[model samples]
Target chain A: MYFTSFEQFINMNGHGFYVWLSYACFALLVVTNIWVAQQRHRRLRKQIKSRLGRSAKV
Target chain B: MSWFDNWHLPKWFYQMASPKWFYDFGARLQPWFAGLALILISWGLVWGLLYAPADYQQGNSFRIIYVHVPAAILGQSLFLFMAVAGAIGLIWKIKVAFMVARSATLVGASFTALALITGAVWGKPTWGTYWVWDARLTSTLILLFLYTGVMALNQAIPDRSVAGRATAILAIIGSINIPIIKYSVDWWNTLHQPSTFTLTSKPSMPPEMYIPLLLMVIGCYCFCAWLIMQRTRNEILDQERQSSWVARYLED
Candidate 1:
């Protein structure tokens, strides 16, 4: 709304590259952190489940 | 007798010390924290990037403050949180406290790195350089190193108890850098500007700019809480895999 057009908004008056790049990095950081945590949790759950299965078999 | 033993602590404090209780409580709260973080951060970033007025001097480049300040603030605060949690773990020998401390290291390190990178990028446009060895910058860099050092130390030690104690001591020692980081711009001449917010004074920026920043800061805290809870739950599972409660937890 501040910018009259979408293009102007994206351009950010010639500082667009810097602004967008910083945000990209931030997005990457957030996504990577969440993804890694979720993956670790999933892996641990699987490992525990399999271990439990083996013990029950014995 | 221990100092806390004489005092009557609240019920939630004792309940929080139990890993199982923490895991269940975290499970109940994690989704809410994550949802709130998502909503607030997106709203803040949008408002900051599009709606907030540009700085008179820095122009649109100043928008980086939204990310930079929040990341930097969270980075420092999380370290302090880690140190305090580590201290609690050391003083009380609480397993959950140690686990929470351990979970905080990676998140703290990531946010510190985020702050440094955003600061550098913002610097390129405003200060005409990507990096500087100024007091504030250097201290923040040290904070990042301190976090990594704790992580590496924990990984190097084989036994969990030993690793916990070792990292706890290291975190407490490294906490000295936090205040130094806080006062770096004041204590020494630095290219970095002074803090935008202080307890005794109002924020330097206008509400339009700072409001988004406030949202971002609170959102980041929520995100950190969600992430830390998720990781701590994982830690509890890993540590208590052999316990009967964990087995029952896995079943249900």
Candidate 2:
């Protein structure tokens, strides 16, 4: 409903490239954020699990 | 216990200081927000990009609104959130607040970058150049540098606690510039056009176009919030790994 079609919408008359590229940049940033979070989560999870085991033994 | 009735502000924030609380909270809320983010972003983009009619003058180039405006708004708003979070952590010495500040700093940087890049692209055909040193554009560049400064401050200090205070101070002080960046387009006769979506002023465009724009902006904001929660939770876990609750978390 935002537009009629992807191509039609992107075509922004003749400004499709700019609009689409701007979106490309947007997508890039979002994906990067998600990736960084996931990576940190993995690292932290491992760290917490390891520390918990050592503390338990101690 | 329901997450609602039991929630008290002080205890709630204090509990959030625990990595276990953050992890559980993030895990619990992730699906809801993820779904919301997906739905809003999809519906909004579809409406803005497909349903909305192209502008008569700019033709299709005006479609950049779907991305440009939302990113610009989120970019500025995210920095404000960072400054607030940083200030709270600095004043209260709350570890969770600091983590949230750190997450927001990174997110703000990314959003600011997206805004400038998108704005430049949108400028080329309309303004007859890829970039112009318009007042708004120049101020936005400064905004991006401010984001970098916060990020750099976070990394520079070796001590985590000290770094938190330092970054928080910088973020809060730098926040003063946010309003300036926002008004630059308005106050100065800048090359950048004024905002399409305004509160008091009636929109010049048709409902079809404005509707999509509204959707995109809302969806993007939700997406940013969800991402911040996830990142902040990660930071909390990293910091509180020595705690018993973290041990309990690992057991799960």
Number of the top-ranking candidate, with TM-score as the measure = 1
Supply DockQ values for each candidate.
Answer: 0.81, 0.65
lDDT per residue (tens digit) for residues A1-58 in model 1: 5788999988988999988989999999999999999999999999998898899899
Off by over 4 Å in 1: B181-203
Looking at model 1 chain B, report the run of 10 residues with the lowest lDDT sum.
Answer: B194-203
lDDT of 1 by residue, B1-252 (tens): 287668777899889999999999999999999999999999999999889998877889888888988898888999889999989888767889999999999999999999899888887776678886555566778889889899999999999989998999999988976676557645664345454322112337889989999999999999999999999999999999999888887876
How close to the true structure is residue A5 of candidate 2, measured as C-alpha lDDT? 61
TM-score of chain A of each: 0.96, 0.66
What interface RMSD does candidate 1 have? 0.8
Q: Which stretches of candidate 2 lie over 4 Å from their true place?
A: A1-13, A50-58, B1-13, B17-19, B180-203
Compute the lDDT of residue B246 as modeled in candidate 1.
Answer: 85
lDDT for each residue of candidate 2 in B1-252, tens digit (9 for 90 to 100): 244445457768778766567778888998788788889889987777666776766667777768877877887888888889887676556777888888888787887788788778877876778786655555668889998998887888988888888988887888886676657645664344444322113348788878878888888888888898898888777777666776775798
The CA lDDT at B148 in model 1 is 87
Per-candidate iRMSD: 0.8, 2.2
